[model samples]
Target chain A: MAILKTENLNYVYSQGTPFEKTAVRNVNLEIEKGEFVGIIGHTGSGKSTLIQHFNGLLRPSSGKIYLDGKDIWADKSQIRQVRFRVGLVFQYPEYQIFEETVYRDIAFGPKNMGLSEQETDRRVRATAQRVGIPESMLEKSPFELSGGEKRRVAIAGVMAMEPEVLILDEPTAGLDPKGRELILNQIKEYHKTMGCTVLLVSHSMEDVARYASRLLVMNRAEVFCFDSTAEVFKRSAEIEKIGLSVPQITRVFNILREKGIDIADDVYTVKYAKEKILEYLKSGGKLQ
Target chain B: MIKDITLGQYFPGNSVVHRMDARFKLVITMLFIVMLFIGSNTISLEVGFVFTAMAYLCSSIPVKLIAKSLKPILPILAFTTILNLFMITSGMPLFQWKFIAITDEAVETSVFMIVRILLLIAGTSLLTYTTSPVALTDAIERLLSPLKRFKLPVSELAMMMTIALRFIPTLIEETDKIMSAQKARGADMDGGKIKDKVKAVIPIIIPLFVSAVRRAGELATAMECRCYRGGEGRTRMRQLKSGAADYVSLGITIFFLAAVIFINAID
Candidate 1:
């Protein structure tokens, strides 16, 4: 089931001006329900521009974006409803926090949805817990929190709305490795617990390889590939040609094979690579 | 909705107007303004219109850019027209309501004032559109270099203007990004009551100010890293030189000013 999709979408910045640029051109996309999809592309490859159109933050220059079989642009007046259905957390999403308290910041989206106060409060706490924001810290001003805490509050702001699809653009940007891992883990848990579609847009190969079940590769304003994670990583050479690399472990495995070691070419993550190497050693080099 | 600001925006072009020295362009623009004011009667006004049209044609800027300059000032233009319509009483009155009256002279004056304002904006916009900001600042500094005798920090002032103009687009982009982030979280900026709209802007304004302060701090550090020691011994890489085109433009402007004065004296 395609929960959110774009057909023949085209987006041009500063159109009709001398500064005109086609950021995302003639791209079609389909996102399924409950699929953790990671969009990978180098900077300015139209990753941000493309995801912005997913939630109607930007209107495409041409073609259609359909959310659950309904064209989002069919009625301009109702476009805001699309944003509520497909929530977007922009790069450095933490900077958007503005309420007096963390709780208020988290409740902002649900409140805008016009939910009852009790329902908004319930969603806020529930989402906060999922995002690992402590209940005691909810009373503090969002400005008073540390950077990582502020990030969690901002993500919780959108999560409280419980959108059918969540799209986060580089949510773990500019964080320590531990902070990055913690947030990624929580997002993975959220996807499993809520069973909602997740679209994580990132340039880091490792982050997506570790979490996303599917991958959407973008190159120069077009979709390069949209396939299962294993299938996409198998085309590491093609990915590298477009200035995007495969996971480091995948590269190590590829190098091992080039050096005459019979290692599986499909290994993408460190843990899986570890398991594969251990199994190969235990099997005493024979295939059967 | 905030992208319509075209004021002081430079469009890169290679027309003779664009290639002429910026100092000459600045001097000519002021001379043109004086000529516009000197033209008092219908004959000189028509002459002034022709002069402006010639300048526009030579500049090769798009006709639509003039309309862009007028879009944001619609309210001010309306106010100017309304104020001149009833406030000044001259010639025969066409409509009268107590103290409020619209005379034929006032109508003519209103039309003249509106055209003058539009022409003034178009003329100034031509300077910005044709010349880059770096060139404009260099021209300003050189034009005011004589004031250095009085210890007036001419280079510093010019540098300030340069940086300010350079950062306007950057700040606008930052504001747009911040607004998008907030709007994604459902900040109702557009469709709100007057009070609600103003209230909604608080989120945007606070972050913008904070980031602006941070950027200033970062800029100071970056400048110091490059061993910037003020403008005391600064030498520019591109020295300003008055070319043949500059002299020709000056000659044409001087002729137009003389023509406007000649027309006014005859009237």
Candidate 2:
């Protein structure tokens, strides 16, 4: 079942003012349960605006957002409940970490949900462990932690809520390569272990290609395409036209294909590209 | 939701007001404010109103923009008007019940005070509306250049003001971002009692303060890297100059002040 869906969502900034702008328009999308979806777009492509709608951080000027085939906005009193069900980890999540201790920081969300002290502690500890935060560090101040550690604690704070649908906007931004891989892998592990729906918004095509089962391409405030990872990569030319490139490995394969080499166009990662190149070299392929 | 603030917003235009020297404009604004206070009767108030209207017209700024500028101060205006209505005592009483008596003089004073306050805001808003913040700060530094001989850091003070003005919108944006992030984590900003609402702001304020300090530290380092020393022997990219229009504007402002003084003396 589609856990979250939007029909023709539209948003305008400074609505009546002379500086008014239509940020997101006519955006239609659906996310099924237990599916890891990746959203990719250039800056100012309405990616943030669209994700903001998923958690009700922003209301559409027109149209509806449905969660579990019911309107999320049906009951004004239940809007806060909807936010817990759809946890959104915004970019630079570290800025939102305010608790004196990492443990208290992680417990903030669950406590807000009115969970019992024991239950909140259990969930906070479980989430901290899940995100690989050391037990000793949980008692330390969030401000005293390193940048990457602070980020993990912040993500764990939302994860402690155990939302049915998780949305992370650029979770790996400003991290070193190892930090990036660790964070992405932790998110993938969480999705797998919890069997929850995940949506990752990223600028790096390679990151999306490596993790997401489905890809939703947004260009200029509209969905350019939404399909399986392999299917979306097939339209690499159209994606490139909008000032976004495909995965680096996919670009190399496209170059090889242009030279009449018998390589698959859908090879997006380095590991897959390596296998394809080895096969081509062994098959008596001539260098052009 | 906090992005709707229009405080200190500068509107760009190419009218005579925009072209007037910033220092001259600042001086005129001060004179206009002084004139607002000098009025003692209807005649001087009328003169002040006409001059303010003429200044607004010459700026070519839309009337709606000036009205919008007053949006944030409406509550203050209402409160002051109400307080004046209760405090003033003179003339025929309209309502008398125990300690609270609304008199004709109270009514008159309230209306006049409200009008004076609104006109004060509108007239000063004209300076911000026409002059960009950068130009305004530059003009302030130049106007205060004489204080440099007294060992005052005029340029440094102006630079601090410039950075503060530049960052108001940015900090507001950061606050909005932090609030949304916390809201996503189920930090309930709404649907709370008075105590709960104030308590809920703790999460918001902590992060905001931390980020503001971080930004300040980063900005300080950046300034140091750019070799930004104090006002000593510093040169500006945009130099302040007084032109024919500036002289004309100053002359008109002086004439208006003279008229206000004459009306005050006669009244």
Off by more than 4 A, model 2: A274-288, B94-101
Clashing pairs in 1: none
DockQ of 1: 0.62
Across residues B152-258, which tens digit of lDDT does each residue of candidate 2 receive? 98988999999999999889899899999999999888866999999899999999999999999999999999898876787877787779999998999899989
lDDT of 1 by residue, B109-209 (tens): 99998888778878878899999999999999999999999999998899889888888888898899989888777777789689998988988987788
Residue B98 in candidate 1 has what lDDT?
Answer: 88
What is the C-alpha DockQ of each candidate?
A: 0.62, 0.86
Reference-based lDDT, each prediction: 0.88, 0.91
| Chain B TM-score for all candidates, comma-separated | 0.95, 0.94
